[model samples]
Every structure is written in structure tokens, then in C-alpha cells.
Target chain A: MSHVQGDAKKLLARVRRIGGQLGSVERAIAEGAECGAVLQQLAAVRGAVNGLIFQMMEGHLTAHVGGQDSGMPEEELAPVLAVLRSYMK
Target chain B: MSHVQGDAKKLLARVRRIGGQLGSVERAIAEGAECGAVLQQLAAVRGAVNGLIFQMMEGHLTAHVGGQDSGMPEEELAPVLAVLRSYMK
Candidate 1:
């Protein structure tokens, strides 16, 4: 069975952090915060989110496609590849 | 040794596609492509890359942190978490 997975506590914490960042962005806009400051925070949030994305991507590669010992066959690897290819398009 | 990982052929194909898209972007800019068209392509590229990132992230979680059978302990999973946390910063 493909079990439910992931570091739940950690993921939750990440969501919280991102949420706070977004909140700050909203507040900045609501309170007439400097454009530079607002943009800087937004960029930070984007970068942070991207960083998380990379980690998850790396983890996925290690688990499914690369496999622990038995490598995923070409046929099985196709969907995984298709997923990646779609993003590049 | 963390053996060389990822689907080389597939990854190569992805890079090629992304490269082509980027080239198109460059050409569009050079040829004074319409702002709307340029923005649309840029957005498409961003979305595509994000999709790839999600796949990788999902794979990593499945392989390492989730584990096929033996669940990774909290101690062992810390580094993985740290990586994730950094991204969400």
C-alpha cells in the first residue's frame, strides 16, 4: 500500500511561516507600507517558497524515481518524467 | 556513496525544453514581442518550473522521509526537515 507520508509537524510549521510572511505583505499593503519594503518581503516569501519546493523535489527524486535499491523502470519513470517535463514547458 | 541520481535522459530532455522556452523568451524580447505575449510566456515558464518542483518535492518525501517500509526517525529526519524549513523561511 502507498502509505500516507511526510514530516507533518515540519510541514505545518512551514505553512505557518509562509502564512505569517503573507500576512505581513497584506499588512504592508493595507497600511501604506513602502513599496520597496513590501516588494522585498514578497520576494523573500517567493524565494522561501521556492527553496521549500526544491527540497521536496530532491526528496521525491531520492524516493520514487531513483529508488532505494531497485531502480524505477523506464516505463514507471515516464510519468515522473512527464511531471517534470510539464513544468519545463 | 550517494550514487549519481535522477533520470539523466529525462532530466536532459527537461533542460532542453526549458532552454527552448527561454530562447523563445529572448527572441520575443529582441523582436519587441508584445508585452502581453511576453508576460504570458514568462508566466507559463514559471508555472511549468513550479510544477516540476512539486514533483521533485513529492518524490523526496516518498523516498527518504516517508520511507518505503522503515519510517525515518525524527532524529534522522531532522536534516531533511531543516532543508524544508529553510525553503519556507
Candidate 2:
């Protein structure tokens, strides 16, 4: 598989795992687990999820956006930038 | 500002706007706006937000992770990877 697709799959898997954690946290909250403990676990889950997000975004920049010396042709950057702009909107 | 910092600030601003959009969506649902319209707007907001996230991730990979021809030295990729791993957890 292409590197981008592989990376995306890895990210999706990680996200799914985090989704499970979120569900568990929700259940914990519903069950009235100790507030502090529950909050702590929830915070960890959030951090983990955010971290994966950060990495995925970073991966996109490297693999697609082609910064200073990406070796990728300038023309290729347009479609990527176009996608980014669409997202920003 | 450093390019990385500038990009991050722009990303954060975009995210905050999306957060507002989410809040508005909640308000719309609370007030009983047409479900179809509200869901449509909510979907648009989600798409937009995800798009920005995609861009930001791409930027991080380019600026920090240093793909194939990155003028960045190998050692530089370590700390970034470390941080990414932390996030993954």
C-alpha cells in the first residue's frame, strides 16, 4: 500500500481504540465512579486522542503538503493546498 | 513568527471557530430548528473542522517530522516522534 494509505489506516485504528476508551469513560461517568479518578482517565483519553490527531496532521504535511525541501513538484502542492483551504472553510 | 508557530496559531483560530459552530448547532437543536437543516449545517461544520485538522496535521509532518528529503537531520525526527508517541498513548 502507499505510505499515505498505510498511515491513514494506522491512524484510524488508533482512533477506534480511543473511541472505545471514550465509551468506557462515558460508562464510568454514568456509574458514578470517583469524580477525580474518572476525570483523570478521561483526560488521559483526550490527550491520547489529541496526540494521535497531531501526528496524523503532521504526517499529512510531510507526505502531501511538501514544505521547504519536499522534493515533490510544485504543481502537486496545489491540490493539497486546495484541500486544506476547503477544510479551513 | 516562526513558520511552525504561525501555522499553529492559524489552526487554533480555525478550531475555535468550529467550536463556535458546534455550540451553535447545539443551540439550534435545543431550539428545535428543522432537524434536517440543523443536521445539514452540523455535517458541514464537521467537514470543515475535519478539513482544517487534516491541513494542520499535514503541516506538522512537513515542518517537524521531515519526510524523505527533509533537510532536517535524522536526530531531529526523534523528539517529534517522541511527542507523537506520547499523543498516541
Candidate 3:
């Protein structure tokens, strides 16, 4: 496993937070919370999820693509980077 | 706007890739790809999304929660970390 995988416990902790945020959204909807408030919570969830995505990409770049001992050539890394770039947007 | 926001271009590139992946899945369904093939592609998209989510969470931790000189104390960070843990799982 890679370093990220090795740190799964920490990573999973973050994921759980996202889930909890989602549950809050669900509850807000069910409880008839104000539309604006619900929307804000939803946006927060989106931002949090985006944060997680960014971290994973950084890890991949550091450990797999740009690591000092990485055997991956620039040509191969280019396409992966391209995909990563788009996903982040 | 912090370091991550400054690097938005690269992050957006990754987001676009996810979009493209979703498009491919759509096309596969429209073209009547074999059920197994379609399912496999869908799974790939799921993994890609999960990867993106992981990246985002890591960035939040380093930049917002644990950055050098951050004023936020561990007590505040703990609740955030707890939420993240659940989201990851």
C-alpha cells in the first residue's frame, strides 16, 4: 500500500465527517429548515468534499508521479495530471 | 484565498477530467455497451470521484487546520477531524 493507504485511518476520519455533514443536510430538509440555511449547509458539504478530492490528488502527485524515486516518466504523468486537473475544477 | 485557491487552475483541470469520465459513462449507456462493460466504467468513475474527495480533505487539513502559524487550537480541530473520519469511512 502507498503512504496514503497506510494513513487510511486518518483519511477515513475525514470521510466520516463528510457523511455526517450529509446527514445534517438530510435532517435539515426533513425538519423543514429554512431554504437558505439548508442551501448553505449543502454548499459547505460541497466544499468539504472538494477539499478531500484535492488532498488525494496531492498525495498521488507526491507519492506516485513526482516522488524522488518514482520511475514514471513525464509523458505518462502528463495524461494523469491532465485528468487530475480537470477533476479539481 | 490560500495556496490551494492560488492553484485553482490545476485543480479545475482534474475536475474537468471527472466530467469527461462521466460523459464517457453516459455515452457507454447510450451506445448500448455491454452491461458488464458499462458497470465497469461506472465503477471507474466512482473510484475517480473518491480519489478527488480524498485530495480535498487532505488540503483542508494541511492548509486550514494544521498550517504553520495557524491560530486554531487542537480542541477546535478535534471536532472537524471527527467529522472527516466519519466521511472517509
Candidate 4:
């Protein structure tokens, strides 16, 4: 299996948390929490989803595209890593 | 501005890479690369998107939900962190 598939359990766990955060957002809205409070929860959910995307991207690049095993030089990988690191910022 | 917004440049860079990866997949298909090859590219794109999602989630949790400045106790944060760490694994 590819590295991402091998790590499916962990990835799924993260997705589950994202799901939970979404549910929290819903509950917050339903309960008529302050607008600011509900927005905070929503923002949190968005962030979580973004985080998941970042992790998947990094794994794909390292394991599938370039890695120590892939014999790709650091010089070749540097720009990609820079982009990724910036993206995670 | 929120931390995520403050880091928008980096995040956008990551998103751009994801866009580039997606385009590569399209090009691979157009060139009629072998099924396995195309599949590999597609998988990489998927992983990249997932990586982005993962990073967003972690940032939200730390910067928005709980953090050193948030004054939330580590005891309270532990379960959430555990969930996130497991998700990232």
C-alpha cells in the first residue's frame, strides 16, 4: 500500500475530528449561541479541514513523488518543500 | 487578524501547489499515461488535498480552539491533542 493508505487509520481519525467539529458548529447554531461564538466554532471547523488537506498533500509529495527512497535530490525537492511549508503557514 | 488569515500567503502557496498537482493529473490523462501511472498521479493529488486539510485542522485547534494564550489547561487540551496526533499519524 502507498504510505497514505498505510496510514489510513490515522487519517480517518483526523477526518472524524473534523466531522465532530462540524457537528459542534451545528449545535452551536441550533442552540442560538452568540454570533461570535458560533463563528469561532465554524472557523475552527474550517481550519481542521484545511489541516487535513495539508497533511495529505505532504504525504503524497514525500512518499509518492519524492523521498529518500525515490533518490530525488534535496535540490530538486527544496522548491516543493518550500511551497508546502508556506502553504502550511 | 486570525492566525490563519495572517498566514494567508503561505496557505495560498500550498493551495497553488495543489492546483498544480491537479493540473498534472489532467495532463497525465490527456497524454494517455498507463492506468497505473495516472492513478499514481491522482493519488498524489488526493494526498495533497488531504494534507492541506490536516494542517488547517491543527492550526484551528491550536490557535482558535486551544492554545498557550487561550488559557485552556493541558488536561483539557490533552484529549483533543490526542485525537489530532492520532489523526496525523
User: What tens digits encode model 1's per-residue C-alpha lDDT throughout B16-73?
Assistant: 7877888899999999989999999998787666555554555544454454453343
TM-score, chain B only, every model? 0.66, 0.62, 0.71, 0.79
For each candidate, C-alpha RMSD in Å? 10.3, 12.7, 16.0, 13.3
- Model 2 lDDT, full chain set: 0.64
Candidate 4, residues B1-89, lDDT tens digits: the string is 55556555665566566556555644544454444564565556556545555565666666755766676765786687678666544
- Return the top candidate by lDDT: 2
* Ranking of models by DockQ: 2, 1, 4, 3
Worst 10 residues of 2 chain A by lDDT: A80-89
Mark the regions of model 1 whose C-alpha exceeds 4 Å error after superposition.
A1-4, A72-89, B1-89
lDDT, candidate 1, A1-89, per-residue tens:
22115655666687789899999999999999999999999998987676556446545444544454533443544555455333322
What digit string (tens of lDDT, one per residue) describes model 2 on residues B23-54?
Answer: 88999998999989898888879677656755
Cα distance off (Å), candidate 1, residue A48: 1.3
Give the lDDT of residue A80 in candidate 3. 80
> How does residue A12 of candidate 3 score in lDDT?
56
Candidate lDDT (C-alpha), each: 0.60, 0.64, 0.57, 0.59
Residue A20 of model 4, lDDT score: 65
Q: Residue-wise lDDT of candidate 4 within A31-70, one digit each (tens)?
A: 4454456446555655654565566666667775676677
DockQ for all models = 0.07, 0.13, 0.03, 0.04
Two-way DockQ contest, 1 vs 3, winner: 1
Tens-digit per-residue lDDT, B15-34, candidate 3: 55655655664555455454
Residue B79's lDDT within candidate 2 is 55
